[model samples]
Target: MSEINKVKVFRVQGTGPTPVTVKISRIGKALRIKCDCPAGAYMDPCEHWKSLFTGEDQNYLDITDDEIREIQDWLDDSDLDEALQNLLYFEGHEKNMHENLARQKRALRGRVIDILISDPQL
Candidate 1:
């Protein structure tokens, strides 16, 4: 059996008032897994979502199992960011890679702003 066919299950903590537990199970020939999140059922798994299943941090929202499988398929077939972008769209969110990058750049600029604001002569 291929690695994709192997069954993998993960328990993730939720961020709600009551921490939620998520379970992911790998399904077929593709490196797809099934998730127990409400959104997980409709969307593919993302690295963040996969992290949830792999005992990583709980930064991802709940998703469905089939969606996890689809994500796995995309990951296997495409680049990481491409797969992620596709997965993001599946979750009703648009991937703003450029925007995020710009935000990071702006944050870096803040250091310059601080230096300028703190006048040495003042």
Candidate 2:
């Protein structure tokens, strides 16, 4: 069978923290499922995938193409936000160069500290 490369988006509703977005793509007979939750962050198959592929339950609703576009737009906007943040961190005028660099360094250090504090592996 020919593989359809188009991705299908779905929202899984459950009694968990919040609804999770799942994207599935089919290549041949194999299905690649991805989710936005922490479990999916490491590219692990999530509950959303189990339900769809394991035939346990169909807990997800297929989302429209417009909804997918909106999600993509939001992700693009987040990239823009990160770019703006980097500009504030590293591209300031020379007059406040030291201060700006220091501030950015502090922000990064804080992130490291936070991760270390919360991460089980640390």
Candidate 3:
């Protein structure tokens, strides 16, 4: 017989009054995440947050929790095609920065899936 064990999950929650929060929880054999940003709610990575995490680009933009929520709301209402276009734009922008083409491709695919779930039309 197999015994069930609990897995510990880590998350990166944004700072400031309106911060972007990433909550990672274990679901079955995979990890589930919930984000407070527009792209986050869609489970898609936001360029701003990604930049902060990866240090790929810096815009010096201070994102508040409210702003993150607002962005999530907007994303919830955005069209699928538009969301995909936005994702593709980000992927293209990141192409040159990532040295590993395979990693970049995987990242792009994940982003596309997130976008599709958020907006199936795309």
True-vs-predicted CA distance for residue 68, candidate 1, Å: 15
lDDT of model 2 at position 57: 59
Candidate closer to the true structure by TM-score (higher is better), 1 or 2: 2
Each model's total of backbone clashes: 11, 0, 6
| Candidate 3: regions farther than 4 A off | 1-17, 47-94, 97-122
lDDT of 2 by residue, 1-122 (tens): 54434567778876577888887664443445578888899976566655442235545666654654544333223423354336434534553877878999999999999999999998
The C-alpha lDDT values of all candidates are 0.52, 0.60, 0.50
Clashes of 1: 11
Task: Quote each prediction's TM-score.
Answer: 0.36, 0.42, 0.31
Query: For candidate 1, what's the RMSD?
Result: 8.8
Off by over 4 Å in 2: 1-3, 27-31, 63-122
Q: Candidate 1's residue-wise lDDT over 15-57, tens digit each? A: 5454334443333423344555566756655343555324445
Stretches of model 1 off by over 4 angstroms after superposition? 1-4, 17-29, 44-48, 52-56, 59-122
What TM-score does candidate 3 reach?
0.31
Candidate 2 lDDT for residue 41? 96
Winning model by TM-score: 2
How well is each residue in 1-122 modelled by candidate 3, as lDDT tens digits? 43222232223444445545554333333333455767776767665444432345433344444544433333332343355457667786787567577788999999989999999677
